[model samples]
Target: MFRLNRLTDYAVVVMARMANDGCKVRTAPQIAEDTGVPLPTVAKVLNALARDGLIVSQRGASGGYRLGAPPERITVAAIIQALEGPIALTACVDGQSGHCESESLCPMRGNWDRVNNAIRGALEGVTLEDMTAGLFVPMGERRSPAALQQASGK
Candidate 1:
């Protein structure tokens, strides 16, 4: 199945934690310790997030990272795209048309594009505020036992 890499997941976790903490400038080591992520990994993710304009960084004694914009304004898709490139299910669906030689005749390309759009829509629909406030759950759906089991590898 298509899934985000562990690095991307960790990036989200780190960002979410920061967002919840009011996006105050935070040291990577501190965020790492609080979030239970490796220090080096947190550093890497912080750099990437800063580079992508999702967060800003300062150096020296009072330096650290904070959200470039308000948490409510940043969508989950922006965070994912900041660390990972565009969210494309199949390579052909990526905006780089030159990547695929079969672009002119690929029958599945349109379908894949539709699916990608749907996924993108859902991700873009969610903001960091939704995450930080524990509003990620949809109104009618509950976390199923199977889903919990899968998440825990039970």
Candidate 2:
């Protein structure tokens, strides 16, 4: 089955959490606590994301990590690529060979690229902001429409 690995899943969660509060520089331990992901795993995920320029890490007491760019500008495809590399379903899709002996003889050669590109395009269309829209409410933001109306005594 085509599914994201556990760490990649954690990365998405971590990223979404960061997106909700993009201004604050968050430490891995704080992120782990917030996202319920383990510390070691969060550290691992953070390092990879930093290396890929998805998140920027800093030092000193006030320094931590924050999104490299606005959440709306960062695509899910970039996140997946950061943690898992390319999105190709098969090695032979993008001129890659030697994984399968019959690669050259395969009838469906090159067709997988279309499939891969479609999936990539879909992922690219979804920004981190898109993924977290309405999923998180900040400190003073109303939780939902009902809550907003209720607060107004509607």
Residue 27 CA displacement from its true place in model 1, Å: 0.7
Residue 110 displacement (Å), model 2: 1.0
* lDDT over C-alpha atoms for residue 106 of model 2: 90
Give the Cα RMSD of candidate 1.
Answer: 7.0
> lDDT tens digits, residues 38-110, model 1?
9999989998898899989989998988888888899999989988899878887745577778888877766
TM-score of 1: 0.80
Q: Which stretches of candidate 2 lie over 4 Å from their true place?
A: 138-154
TM-score to native of every candidate shown: 0.80, 0.88
Model 2 Cα lDDT, one tens digit per residue, 1-154:
9998998989999999999987799999999999889999999999999999999999999988999999989999999999999998988878777888888789998899999999999999999987876665665764878775565466
Highest-scoring model, lDDT? 2
